[model samples]
Target: MRIPKLASVFLLMACLVAYLTYVKWHIEGIKPALFKVPYQHSGTESDDDKQTSPDLSSDRFQYGIMFDAGSTGTRIHIFKFLLEENEPPKLSHETFKAIKPGLSAYADDPDKCREGIEELMEVAKGTVPESLWNSTPLVLKATAGLRLLPGEKATQLLDKVREVFEESPFLAKGDSVSIMDGTDEGISAWITVNFLIGELNDSDGATVGMLDLGGGSTQITFSPQDKTIQTSPIDYITSLQMFNRTHTLYSHSYLGLGLMSARLAILGGVEGQPLGGSQELVSPCLSPDFEDRWEHAEVVYTVKGQKAGEPVYESCYNKVEKVLYRKVKKAEEAKEMNFYASSYYYDRAVDIGAIDENIGGVIKVNDYSEAAKKVCNSIVETPQEHPFLCLDLTYISVLLQELGFPKDNVLKLARQINHVETSWALGATFHYIESLSRQQMTEHTGKEDKMAALSAQ
Candidate 1:
């Protein structure tokens, strides 16, 4: 009794060491990012609606998590249903926090890459509301940056993320982290914008087309009916995809477009032989219509000071306009030369050639005023091919018919409803859930499996 056994003492010391190590690691893993209060900005359900009750059993969830891993950063958005019964969750109520430890951080080692994802997950989890801690679904998806990374790094990183976050009871258990395809990411981007514009419709009577132009690739989707794509509680339009036609909406990512466009427009057409340099003064065509173009350019403007003085002109274009003007002149020349050299490029130069041959080149010639009237009429009356896709909505409408959406109702919805570009995480999660439920059904014979049992009935 006076002395304990040496073996027992050794075992006790090992246990103490293990406990301390776990505590240290856990504390170190805590992320500092804070979650903003998830509050509804519009269309929130009213708590006082006594007739309506929160249907926790509904297969559809209003609250979930989306992780967007892009080239420059990782953003985790928490979408929560802040409304009470009888109220629909406002899509705008979603809140997010982003970390800049990009996918390139893991360019060398899978372990480091895994750490980046884990860090984001930790930060996201820590910031969400305590009430949603257990019920919120987490959808994880990576962008081209992550997916395009070669070697075992991408797969290993995914496995490690699954190992770390899958253990959390808060995450929907039994499902792995979602991995997105290029098409899914494109769809989500469109979805986000479409939802922002309040254009998602709930019906099978309409269809829509969506287009998403990303940094590396472009995504185009066509939905035929509103609910054919998924068995989601919401009445979402559905359609097949048109992977072959990337140009239906005329989106050309071309690897360097975003950066090159900015650089050329800002720096005067690269060095050595242009307007910014000597011996290059050819008096490029500076259009008098430049102001009109500027007004239409997509740019974020800034006001130097509130008026009291003459309007402080601080358009972002002002910084690069002159340089861009020269570049545009050069571009026109380049295009002409390129066209002159390549017969294929010049074939479609005229509108008559671009029109479908089936239409027999019915080029409707009209006077200026008549042309304006027709253009406006077409813009207003054209039927949508998909209702949910709003990005480049006009272009999407054309794509929808090409993608096999129904002609009348489908096109109308596509025109009227906004589109949400796809999310890799959400789509992957959905596919995974579908697969999982299928597996569970196959494995279970009893009534305890809720999803399977319901299906069986």
Candidate 2:
């Protein structure tokens, strides 16, 4: 084959070019498929979430952002999670920031609420890595504060928040910004506390109960061993699934029973309805000599103490009783379960020095009684910033009794568990992320393609 050396060289060159092209195609196409065979993950997690989690061999990290729109404040919770095979997602880190005067405060001017929402978005952007922004679920669940607003005003406020969320880089759905049912709020908070306390890992173990008192409403949630526990009002019982197990919880949220709302009730003020001109709210809960204007949900009312020498504690207790009687269903099972109290429950306990600021302590139901009695009888000569302390403690005392806690029943109060804030935000975050995973499954499934083809016919 020593014909022309130039012809032989050309022949060799053509063969080499063909082999390189074949190699390129094999590496780009077939090699990927070798490693891409659908990997099966082991777990009892619903099939919808089976593929939502990243591979354990890789970075294996996820993030969730939740905004707790409560009556008193708007808080942003940025959470980082580490995914593991066949186990629950672990919360590795959390970033929390709160701004006062919730969205309802801007009911008259919804546009002004954008500034606070944007500021919180900045915090979220800074906390989460840029690459994960688009994948992270962003949600805002407004609680009792928004629920207390007029229908038109609530819609307007929610619309404003939705506009802001859509503009951000994070993942948000159509229902991202909305009012959360009070019972769901209690259930989410119950999930958070139980998960933080390591109770969710054991299916047979009794999960601790949750008591959350916010500015606009209060929630009580617990899981009783006996299935026959009757939750009067029928709607108070709810079933929630977490980590593949279903929990039957007796949870209720009293709309006007929240600390701030209760203060309004105890002072004889109506919710969402402003007091008319020159109308005054007088109560024995306040100091006999004190007079002031109190503002709640953007409405200001003239509030003051009752006349001097009227048994302050007794009168306050009777008034609180009126507000609570027949309003809250008594849960007899709370006496047997360990419970954790959060929100205003923690704040009031701290105010009275019943629990240390740094290390929260356990207190009996009567502790609130003792503190309320003392706060009511004495007058603080200084600038009484929280004149409602007496009313709050007393209402808590009566509320506990109405909820079936004996005077001597001890309850644990904490603002955080294991360095994580003991609020519904975390539990809600995990739940939201799982929902996103389910949505993704529905979107990417081969069945969708089949359905599209069938519809075309």
Candidate 3:
């Protein structure tokens, strides 16, 4: 307890040295270890990855809902997108559901359409996150089904849909629900295929064509070679600009040439004109032994085959020829371009074993013709469960031939690309985002210009 002064001073110096060392270690090592976040680097992160990676404070998933109201049914497409600040949005997931008897069925009783639209919106509600319900865009685009209806009746149904959209929590902007022009329908489909295949932004990419066969209309769209555009009819040529590239495409949507509509015409039943009660329409395309009632666009018809006569294929071809002859404009350019056919084309091919239902395959125009001939010839010996199979096959064959596709021309039949249904909805969603982005950019530029002028003053 009674230490010398020098010894006590040395003990104090030693204690002071220990304290400084601890402070230095804490500042240079322990504090940094406590506060710094360790990054596990697997590889270099891409610009896209960096942009789309979700911020801990903000969710980056965007949702869009689109309804396709065709002649046969109404379908809902709920798409989930991963959005980046300065990059094109990526489609991360999609939910698709459909209900029968299209919106056109409720044309006369417009009020009845609400239930169907509401049913679809419920699906959207379940698919998207509840927090994003107010920000998700909801849109409905009607095709030829409504286009063929009486203008007033179509308007009434559209107005009813609009009211339903307004009541929903999702964003419903002007033009949210409307009849899509046939040309727009074609272009949208074209966009879907091109975008899904990653060809939109490629300067040297070989873009594929699209063929969509709906109940009431068929669309063909593709970017033709420069010479093809030069020789094509001005009416068949459409200009599309995407990703800052201008594409002059051979795109057209033929009304009344769709499988169902063509069937009506081939059977000699006029659209919108019912043959009153009990009067039957006869066609050679059907099995002579077959007779049934077929319904379309809310109209029922007594349909049957003509009494046995010439060969089934010959007669059926003649009937189908009458339906398509000189009606659909042929795009000579399409013959050389590779095309992807979907909708009824895919369905019919699947029905006949021409393509796989899940993984579609390639088919030639001749394959359809041969299948048609076989189906027509066998109709008499063994009736098909679906009597219209013969007629449908024959019609598809003749339709392709008439459209300038040679018998040898190959078509890829696909119901989906990258697990997403091959249709116009995806394309429509992309277009909507592009439009919004452009508008925002324009506004931002205007604000910048204003600020600059104010600063100068």
TM-score result, candidate 2: 0.80
Worst 10 residues of 3 by lDDT: 30-39
Ordered from best to worst lDDT, the candidate numbers read 3, 2, 1
C-alpha RMSD in Å of predicted model 1 compared with the true structure: 19.0
All candidates: TM-score: 0.41, 0.80, 0.81
Pick out the ten consecutive residues of candidate 2 with the lowest summed lDDT: 30-39
Best by TM-score: 3
The digit string of per-residue lDDT tens for model 2 on 87-110 reads: 666665566788998898899999
lDDT of 3 by residue, 1-457 (tens): 5568889778776765675565444332211001011211212234554455455332466678999998779988887666444345556666778898898888879999999899988888877778988778889999877898899999999999999999999988897899998778888888888877778757799999988888888988888888878887898887765654677888888888888888999999988787877858899988887778888877788898988899998999988887787888777878888999988888899889988889999999899999998999989889697799899999998888888899999999877777666788888876765565455556655765665465446
Q: How accurate locally, in lDDT, is each candidate?
A: 0.37, 0.79, 0.80
lDDT score at residue 18, model 3, on the 0-100 scale: 75
